[model samples]
Target: MANKRTPAASENDRLYGRALAVIRMRQGIPQQRAAERLGVTTQAWQNYEAGLRKSIFTVDGLSRLATALDVDPGLIEQVKGLLKEGVSEAWMSDGAQPLPTSGSEGKVVFFSRRAEPEVPPAEELAPVYGAVFAGKPGAIAFTPDRPDDWKPVHPNQRGYRDPFYLQVHGDSLSPRFEPGELAPAVRGVWPTRGQVCIIETHDGAMLLKYYERRDAQSVWVRELQPEPREFGVHLADIRAVHAVVGGAVS
Candidate 1:
């Protein structure tokens, strides 16, 4: 059984709670959803965040949390050290830690410090945003929080100024793009004819379409799934267009 968190440990709990809050926020996961993922009640999750729950310090709790947050379980030790020793360089390397793999159902493979590698440069990493729709008009608001996951920058994406990745959520661009595929996209690079593009409109909406053609009045695009169709967004209303490079490699 896990030990109860005592009032004397309140400071440590508060500090740990803050770390949990940061990870949860970056993934854009709601408290309710996190609770569901961890097999706990929403109020339990809230208590965990308030430093009132010590159950999370147990082995099972840590495993569930690593899976729930979609981060490495090794991170728990880093966080534990933070609580016991105060601040250090843990946060600096937190973003690039590789995700944990499942050893079996409900079990996460933990890595030892001896097996870890030096932290790579931030530029070599690409932030993987949560699901983005491919067929419909939606909005993707960039948050100050870190992304849900990170991947090594793709070879083809190396030349771009700021390259990132997002998981496809819809199939409007089907065959060419299947749902759940992670695609690399880069800013400043304009999409050419027939290329897949991520477009942001002035109204703050985003769209994924094939670049068809553009004129002074409108920028046209094509969609494949459901039915083949073409549409145009007013040139003045278009905010930015990013090219989704070749699919994520390795």
Candidate 2:
């Protein structure tokens, strides 16, 4: 289903976009830099500035943007007022005002954190390297890629380094991650406690497990389904550990 936008909704989008653009430009914050700091894609940041999306109309979005741009909290209030109450005094004090909306103005969109995100187009799909065992010990060998091995990339993994997908093997992480689902992982990132990770060992063994902790000697990991258990893999035996951002059914 498509997201339908009313005339008022469209106007609100533009109004919020222009006001954010003004503050962002005044602060000399580059869109890419702001997006990187906010942990969003550059295109997502541009959408916020152009008012194409209402993802930034909430308190958390604004707070994060403020931190990214180093803008004062008062400016956030001014922007909110311009959108909600129309023609804020802060804008008037500067002898300029944001474009006025129609009398039948639509309320601003303040999406909850649980709001669904826009889907990525087919062109943005990542490749699935091979399978990683989520239950038993498995080899780290990657099979040859077929013509249809592509999978969707998560929004948060957009700027991650060397992103690739791996088909999950076994049901150890079931009810959350399952067999045959594609797991997106990135290189050069150390997995922290509570995160699922794709771990490669020195002996060509691959594991898909919850990261627990690590010390100079070994890294601890866990599994949930069938039974809950934790174990440690020696750091010297691990070749690489990449965080699994999320899983997608293939």
Candidate 3:
């Protein structure tokens, strides 16, 4: 079944690759940067866009790409048609578009951002070493800027650091994150009740859990919520607030 899935996926991959290539080239962006936007390995993204690997794309994935390029779905298809095999548009969505569909005139691709974004946004990330490892503002050691160790995962991707990204640990925020997912949490200081928060546990664990504030100086962290599970919410201390990761997608 896995093999079967791969073949068809490869087809989508090919078309998907070509479309990405078209979009990147036209927009004058680098392949590595685009790879990060797609959450793919840089080399893998490059291979696909180069049409060296199969073109595979999912409706959800295509939709997301369309959102990033700020274009309509048809615009990608139309642009692809203008290119040759192995030739792809970095801004196009379906890979290299096949030429004028058998006696059909090509319509121009008008770029637009009307297409809704697939996810809230690409999450923001900060260096694990940045600032004080405090979970709340009061506990923080005054630091004016991000740590020197900070670097965007996709250094080549434009505005890569704008969205928040966090690393998570433990099962406190289970269902939403696991130990090995290398959670890419967004950045925010104020998290609504029951939202997962990434913070350095006073006990020395950098973990994520549902956070609640009792007052300015008091807060509690909980586990197994938003639904009943094996565990339940518990009291926690708010040390320093770094960012908010999930919920409220547009």
Candidate 4:
């Protein structure tokens, strides 16, 4: 007969199982698909989700599971509440140290320190504004009303002169700049044809669109998805145009 796990080990397994199940549901990954990606039987995956089996994941196994869910392994540890404050290393090693578990008065550290590569610090941080609609032209009010919201950008980000972040809104640029995504905008950078840009109108209305071209009299812009349509705005009605350097899903 197989030896039974200790009570503490079983409790840890249950916690990990519950955390994994929650993450899978939140990520919208079907159990069958996740099992296939993890190279495990569907029933085995179900057992983990159901807390019927103890979780004893190796480093590779944990990484593979994280990849299948499209999330960082640290996120999994966080969800399970296994990560303790000031505990930088999340994995257990031969020389692992004990950290206090939640609800436990004494320290119960489970992770060990490992010689890992150092990560460089982030470049500069840019203010993240509320959603900016691409379909409607709105005011280009540049102010630090809410300085708390911001995102860090790498120093080498292309066209990153005086860059700021804006959350995208509307489906005018769907798939390219989905609603709720964050986009980096660089001021003082002139955009070329086929490049995405944020345009400010004379009336203070701002909009995001693809820069088709611009003549002495007017500027031509278009939407890329949901339906392609072009607009011609007279040069006299324009104020300033900022090019979109990059974007990421929020």
Compute each candidate's TM-score over C-alphas: 0.47, 0.50, 0.31, 0.47
| Per-residue C-alpha lDDT of model 4 across residues 123-170, encoded as one tens digit per residue | 557777555677665633444366437777623232233657777776
Model 1 C-alpha RMSD vs. true structure (Å) is: 16.8
Query: In model 4, where do residues sit more than 4 Å from their true spots?
Result: 1-120, 138-148, 154-159
| Candidate number achieving the greatest TM-score relative to the actual structure | 2
Residues 40-104 of candidate 1: C-alpha lDDT, one tens digit per residue: 99998888877778868667776667567654455555555444544433432343322222333
Over 4 Å off in model 2, which ranges?
1-116, 143-148
- Across 1-250, the per-residue lDDT of candidate 3 in tens digits comes to 3554323344445565666666655444577766776677888776766555543445555555554443334545644544434332433333222122212233332222333323323443344332332223233332225433343333211222233444333344556665334333433233334555555445433445565433322445566634443322222643344334433211
In model 4, pairs of residues that clash are: 96-112, 98-109, 99-108, 99-109, 138-205, 138-206, 139-204
The stretch of ten residues in a row with the least summed lDDT in candidate 3 is 95-104
Ranking by lDDT: 2, 1, 4, 3
RMSD of 3: 18.6
Name the candidate, 1 or 3, with the larger lDDT value.
Answer: 1
Least well predicted 10-residue stretch by lDDT in candidate 1 = 95-104
Give stretches of model 3 more than 4 Å off. Answer: 1-115, 118-164, 186-188, 201-204, 225-238, 247-250
Candidate 1 TM-score to native: 0.47
Q: Per-model C-alpha lDDT, please? A: 0.64, 0.65, 0.43, 0.61
